[model samples]
Target: MHQQDNGKAETFDVAVIGAGVVGCAIARTYALAGARVVMLEKAADILDGASKGNSAILHTGFDAPPGSVEAACVTAGYREYLEIREKLGLPVMRTGALVIAWTEEQEAILPDLIAQAHANGVTDVEMLSREDTLRREPGLAPSLRASFRVPGEFIIDPWSAPLAYLGQAMAHGAELRRSCKVLGGDFGGTHWDLKLSDGSVRAGLVINAAGLYGDDVDLALIGRRDFTVRPRKGQFVVFDKSAAALAGHILLPVPTKITKGIVVCPTAYGNLLVGPTAEDQTEKDVADLVPDTLAALRARGEEILPGLKDHDVTAIYAGLRPATEEKDYRIRHHADQNYVTVGGIRSTGLTSALGTASYVFGLTEQTGFHYDPPESVHWPTVRNISEAQQRDWERPGNGGVVCQCELVTRREIESALEGPLAARSLAGLKRRTRVTMGRCQGFHCTARLAEMTEGHFAVPMAEATGHD
Candidate 1:
């Protein structure tokens, strides 16, 4: 599996495992800070992990208690998201959010929730009177009595956020080795001895952000094993874009100590996202089993958004949260091992990724390790919104529509095939161009798109389905 690149050995100041939101953000942070970073992902593409498939809510972290690490990190990452999104020209729908209560008992929690929001430094949060709530969102359930309206809360296209981060990292001198699984590693005195699927990669620092399989990655050689993670599966049903306006603001059920309840939120892609059944499962391919939860999710979603019954479901998907037994983030540095373990990132991982990276970098600093910036770090420049992103395909050969289900054109597919972040599977194209993620679920478009990728990338038809 080993392949030589430009007849030279691959080396870096730090090797980041897993290209999920947290891992990519961490690698981007280091790359921007002038570190020679190399990212190793087990998958064919980056951000295809839980990062691409998430709730898509930009939380104010108001529901989190004050002084908790989760609170601090989410709050910080929320602010950082605005800056990064704007800088990258990514679309962030700053439409705000609300937590609605249906009963009197649920109403009682509103005041305390406001207090908690304030405690978390979210000062813009306010308890909405019945009239005020109606004024803001008249379409809300008429039975709702109390709610917390928090501005600055928004919805984002979850796919582009992490991809942009990793894209920026790659532009800024970070090298990414896709589908290169790290078999094991040894804690070198300075550089860690890495055993990758391709071959070996040496790094003075190793950052582990392997999500669900994090423990397995470090089990071969490690130090602190204070916590264990149980995979909690969350199933979601995506409604067609036509029904996206079903809710004006995010409608969230108050969370219990065990789990955050189901939420109905509108995504930046102009689609409604509902469900995400909080069930605990150990299955690795959880997304494939989401059909089993569809009926339950439909019932639960109707209870939240009644008007959504008529909207056709575009797709149903599930992503497993690496929920750990630990109450807070399981981030720790082994100075001697020259490794940092970033595991147990749950559903809120996306909202806290940037902050998590910054904190991890601090841990690296406190360890007394230092690196000079690489001599040459070139960042690839791309438009904030590509031509294909305009909903029109006018780029010569790229303009022929391929994925009719999502209005994705051949130009867009080809761009993904040849661009910096290429697509090797059906799911990869879905995340990048949102093709086949629409109402038909690629029943018609899958074949054409598959043919295009097969011809363009020389990949076998079977492997193009995103199956290993």
Candidate 2:
């Protein structure tokens, strides 16, 4: 990995802006293809943006617009994730999703959605009768309606997946710069000089995978943009672990053109999740939780699974998606300038990231830039934080537990704080080790964590609380 020095401009073959999941995957792809790659993130840590909060479902693209880039990428990325997840120690909860139609009108749309699923190459989707739906999920409210089962859809560890992707990229000689913002750039025909917040770097090609700020990055570097980023905020509510048993499958509502609607699914971390009330907002960064919205979400969750009323609420959070006026993804390649813009990737980004990287790599190749992929690739396995597998606390020599609620160990926390992609803040550490994210929400572990993470975070623990 190349370190930035103030004395001179560092050089690389590729500079991928934004360290979101898509950017991480793009960096990995270029690095594996034998390009010297550098990934930049404006946040204190990777995934501190839109990538941080999500439903964590690995979609089958069953309901995605057929023949669209989103569908193709989701299909390819889904296949690739299943093919490589075991090697990376990524957890997959094979809880197939059920798209239930509560209303008669929604039931009328099931056949068309099933046809769309088949058109998208997911032929295993089968329509289920009301009896079959109730049998599959006994805890679901006895709503007199039918549903379709998308067997390929499953839940995955969202944070660990990208961390593993970037980790493998670093292992294969990719450099990551967190807290580094790309202020502007100059493309000089043969190469590009990117001006960052800290210093400057030169690269032969630049790929804009900046999720929410994608348009801004394109405008800054190329002085033009085809699409404007319209931020759409989605808030969610997480139930306690006990509620996870209520939903055997990912309970999904029939998707609308605007959003996928609310999803009541089980997280890989052994908690039931219901969320994502879609609200269009002008604010790009702050996705504040609304009391009334969350209350409505809780009520909707109870309506889906009547058993949820008995469970306590664990947490509530919100995420912003880089939505645009158009439904399709905004991807364009400028061969003359040696640039590619990947924008307008919304909710399905987690599942489509890898395939998007592959597509973007092909676009980069169109500019006459190519490299021989490494003969042998390094596959780095991330630490298991999901309930689908044995956690560090369950193993011997774990150095004792730190967060009792999540069973996070001292050793695990230390490891997360000591790596190349180390946790630089409380949020980063939580994403890495699941600390302070359980039922107690760090009530019992904050003091201990503060002692352990002192002087490590950019903002000290005493100064910052929930902001990180």
Candidate 3:
């Protein structure tokens, strides 16, 4: 295993093997608990997995079955998210969620949904009449019979949430190693001897939170054969923030036996989102999404909410769900081997991140690694970057609107490029700063961003443009 520059083989209490939303949350939780925690991510930054792309709904877990792991974690995580968001002051549009029923059959499903939500202990749910639904969300298809008004399900800023967790963890003493890929590891005596593509770090315990590739990590580490994963691709489209008032809340269709279908939800950035058509594929290519699937999402959006077409689409994105055949999250702990496996965290991973972290940490504790709770852990209150960063940004070198479409100030891009976890490509920068993810879809910003990425990362212009 490669060692750090200091040559001191530092042993942490635990090492999280992915920096997705769930893994970051777990590392942050452990760091707050006074454990020497380290978060390892393959990409240049965190949230580069299923965490970056999703419906962004703070789900009520109304559809999950009672007594299920997903139900418990989601319920607990929702509450935890509320507290964290309050403390962090991150953006959250609590517009609520409405599962609309257009047909009579779909309308009949609302009662069962209400029953299921109640079974999961999700109270404060209301069954709204068609009239009330129309009044609340006049942009609906108008033929709706009723809707399940799930007040707890709201929309939040997916990008900033995990970043905030990581920022706090970093300030509170968690080491985040970006661009460090864990190739494989073995259970070394008293610790796990971690193997990495770039470098390595040893910890008392290893956590497999690698998102879509989580099972692969598990199989590579322990050769476990209990489960398999298939990446289910979902496509979403964003509308301008001015169109946010086109609907008052998240408009969801009656979920079928297959998936929740596409949804029209408002995002924390004030933009409106419509999408997520689920399609199963055996590949784990997170970057490439089939354009045909995205087209289907646009078609469905037009059908669900007629007013969705009234405005221009800001951007289009695709995310792969870490689908497991079991259709449930696979979280396991091996006390003897000092490993924790977190897999099949699909559509609900974003909402259940905090609770999942708490649960996973408890499993790590079962392995008997001693952890001392911190004496007043003070996380950085970072609503924005420093004044110096702002000043440095107004200069050149990818300055003056690297991504013009998103209004990403040159300062923001410079800060991202030179921050603790600097991005190396347009895609990496997009994940960090939301550049080129707005209206015009990088048409105006591509040239400038590509040039800057080429200059900084030393990649060919064609390569940068090709990737983005």
Candidate 4:
């Protein structure tokens, strides 16, 4: 990472605003393309915005609008993830998704949904009879009328993927600046001087991947706005690990025009996930979890899988999606200013981030600012934290287990604190190592964590607990 001096400004080929999943991927793409890339995040750590909370499902683009930018990016990204995940040590739980219909009206739409899936190149999608559906998933409610199987949808480690992307970018000579907010900037025709919270940096181009505050960044830096960010909050409920056995596949609801509706699925972390009620609000930063909405989600989960009523709720979280007035992604390039606005990326960003980065790179290339591709690209592998793979605790010389709930070892915590992409906050640590995020929810492990992370964080452990 380049340290900005008060007397001198650091320069780069590209400055990517926002270190969310998209921003991380963008940095990796540009860095691999041989551009001196620097990714900036406003938060204390990466993935702290809308990227923090998600279903963690890698979509097949089966239900995405055919021929749309989202669909194209999702297809390309899905392919790229599969191609590179093993090298990067990312985990994927191959739990195919089932779109279930509880009513005749929903069942009637199954064929059309399947048609759309086929149109989107998911040729293996097939409709299932109610009998077949119940036979495949005996735990599902008997009220389920009919369903279709999307054999491609799978659960993934949402945090690790982005971490690996940024890590690889850094390994390839890219820089990451956390807690560095881009206040505004000036386009001097030849380059951009982005004013940061601490100091300014000059870059040949700027890409806005600020996520929830993408619109605000555009207005601040470019002095114009093409779209408005209507924050859509989605609340989720995670059931205990035991509940994961109740459903082997991702049980999805038939889509509505506005949302994909509530989905009852299994997480890569061996927990059953039921979520995300789409509620539109004006707040950009805060994603307040409403008790009533969560209760409704639990009820809906139980309705989808009657066995969920017997399971205990492990956790609840809410994330804001940067929705816009239009359904398609709001990506535009201003060649004259050497700026690109990658905005309105709602859900499915995790699956489409790589493809989005490639798409953004192509747009930047159109501006005639090109760099030679690197002769050698570095692939950095992140430590495995998901249950699908053997954890650090299972390995020898891992110190000792500190968080029994998640089996996080002392070595894992120590390593997470010492790296260039080190966890600077409790929430950041949780995302990196899964510490204090299990059943106990830090009740038993926080003290140990505090002892382990002392003097490493910007905020003291006592004050960070509430925020985490």
Candidate 5:
């Protein structure tokens, strides 16, 4: 492991701040292209912020504004994620999507959406009448006036995507430091010197993919404030797996300019999701769940899918998006400063992650950074062990099942405990193995899980409850 635990100063060819999906993709791509890289995160683990929350939908750019960065990145990233999902053996549910209009006002927007879809390079969208829409999604409101079928959209395992990128990056010699916040930085003409919470690092090139804190990091690096990340709080509700059958495909509402609107979709893990009430806030670091917001989401969900609110609510959570004043992403390259800032990557960031990485790499090249492919490098996969691949050390030999709700076995927990970027917190283990992420939501499993990580995190059982 190249992780610097002693908080000593270091140097690298490339340094990426933030370990969200986009940051991981940037670091991983740089490493794959043979640049020494390091990924820094303020949180205890990657994918711990908005990257893991929000609607985990892989958009096809069907409704993105024409000629926008989001449109291009989403259109390209959706395709790339599909290919990479298969290559990494990650879980992805290609449930397609239905953008339905239930009111006359909303019905009037279908043509424009279709036009936007075509403009964004997505030609697979099809228009459907009320009858056809109901036939496709019987649970949807019978008042549906029309629908647009986007066949390319999918529901992906959000947790594993970042892990795959970071895993490959680490295997290719990139280092990852958790809980390492960038306090400040200075451009030294030849290189950039960054002061971390524990130590410092000197890098030839710096890329800021910091999610909610991008604005703060940008100020530290460039000493200018071109944009501010408005924390848009979005709350969601998850229904038990039993409700998954109610929605065949991801059911979306006709989006408006301000938000994508609440959606009801089936997750890759077999649970139905309804949510994401978009409410922009003045606070930049918001993570609280407003009970009223969740209630309103349920009410809206009932209208989208008849009887949807009746389903047993499994969990409810909120995520803060990094929205900015500009409608487009705040990606810029400073050749003189040897820096790139990737900011304002709001809701579509998950779908646009890989494509954004490619774009950022191009920006880096413009700053005189060169990339050359290595002969061979290791790539890690978190594909759950199949019955056929299970080893004695992975199963009954290690211990017994720890989290039965998610079917997370003892071997999985052990693997997380001992793996690279080892699980040092309950949240870390949850992101890695999906433990404590079921209907019970750790009520039945936290005790055992805490014991397993006691030595690793040195925390008590009560304090080991998973963090948001």
Candidate 6:
């Protein structure tokens, strides 16, 4: 968090651009290796980009093409996620995936998918009969021909992962700068001089995990384009928690080469999620919820879960993935420039974040950076406090309740505001404390949260409400 003053430049051993899940994980990895690391984020908070919105399904790499970086990283990352779940209090659900075959053509693809799963080191995948599939998922279409079950796939709280990693990194002396966009940077023979929005940063080495705008940063820094990041917009609809039972697993349609297809899955927070209509967008196309698309998704959901027709829609939003021309991830080390570009992460970025960070570290090590092991560090546990724990904090003035729908208390929201990775806006607070993100979607709690934030942080109402 140190900024240069009096024309004296502050330097670091490693500077990671983009505070997404991957970037935060890279920062934490570098910090654990005892490097003086600094994470620069363009947004006001972490997970504000593609990392903020996703299907939240931690892939098993079973369907991934073998021998690719994604395949390898996803396999390793799922294991890392299991370990991470033990340390952090984030909601990590081990809900396995069910790839349903509604048509004979889809049924025919199941064996090949099983083969791919085996090739990707996922041996627990099984093809189930239509009767067994119906037995497992009663709400599924009776037209089910067959299904492939992958037991390792899971769902997670996407926001909590990066926040926990960043919190731990910050606690271990890795600096984080919010709203600090890297406009450009120059690499000398021995170091890099980055021109941030506010000021300049000098670093011995740099890692670019700048998700969607990754290509822009790569071209600006390395002076070449190995790939271009085309934003693939995925629109999703979340049903009320009462309809969570519609899909007991990550119910997916058989994959097409173009997309994973629409999926009906349950969130770790007890809600059914559907759609994610994969419509690739041009550079100028913004990520917005298409009502027609949402309607189509709802219709598809009804086909997958007949009960969905009765359930209420809770939320609708869209996220853009940094899709590239290359089938695999575009991770390369510029040894001479003392830089590594981590780009084209796409859908599996969150699932493979830890493995990707480890790979980036290995690349940095190959470039001559070394790590000295630390004994221990404080890893912050950031998640929803239980009702019992909430009661404990009620005696203090911070215990007043706020979001009745989500049961968020004033104490929890304030903690998010005061934490190391403090919320800078309503959206930030929503990700941090789950306030105003429930069924009401801030209809009841936004004004209260905004007022408290404005008064406490001394910010204007617009800024507090995340209007700008």
Per-model TM against the reference = 0.91, 0.98, 0.90, 0.98, 0.94, 0.94
Worst lDDT 10-window in candidate 6 = 384-393
Model 6 spans with C-alpha error above 4 angstroms: 1-7, 385-398, 455-459, 463-468
* Candidate topping lDDT: 2
Instruction: TM-score for candidate 3, please give it.
Output: 0.90
Q: Over the stretch 1-468, how does candidate 6's per-residue lDDT look in tens digits?
A: 244535655888899999989998899888988888899998877787888778888998888879999888888878887887657665667779999998888888889999999999899998899999999989887977999899988888788788888887888889889889998888879878999998888889999999898888988888887898888899999898889877779998888776888989987666788978888877523687789999999999998888898999988888888889986899999898999999999888889998998888888798699866568866677754422123323456657779887677787887888856788766777787777667988888877876788744435555543431
Which pairs of residues collide in model 2? none
Model 4 misses residue 153 by how many Å?
0.7
**Mind giving the per-residue lDDT tens digits that candidate 2 earns over 1-468?**
244545588888999998989999999889989998999889889998889988999999998899999998999999999999999999999999999999999999999999999999999998999999999999988984999999989999999999999999999988889889999999888888999999889898999999899999999999988899999999999999999989889999988989999999999888999988889988888898899999999999999999999999998889999998898888889888988999999999999999999999887787688887789999889999999999898899999999998899999999999978999999999999999888888889999999999989989899895753
The lDDT, on a scale of 0 to 1, for candidate 5 is 0.82
Q: For residue 47, what is the lDDT in candidate 6? A: 83
> Which parts of model 1 have CA positions greater than 4 angstroms off?
1-9, 288-292, 373-398, 455-459, 462-468
Instruction: Pull out the clashing pairs in model 3.
Output: none
Residue ranges of candidate 3 with Cα displaced over 4 Å: 1-10, 286-288, 382-404, 447-462
Better of 2 and 5 by TM-score: 2
Model 4 TM: 0.98
**Which pairs clash in the backbone of model 1?**
171-379, 398-411
Residue 254's lDDT in candidate 1: 70
What digit string (tens of lDDT, one per residue) describes model 3 on residues 51-153? 7788788887889867878877888788898886757646566788888888888887788888888898877889899898888877777777888788878
Residue 424 in model 3: shift from native, Å?
3.8
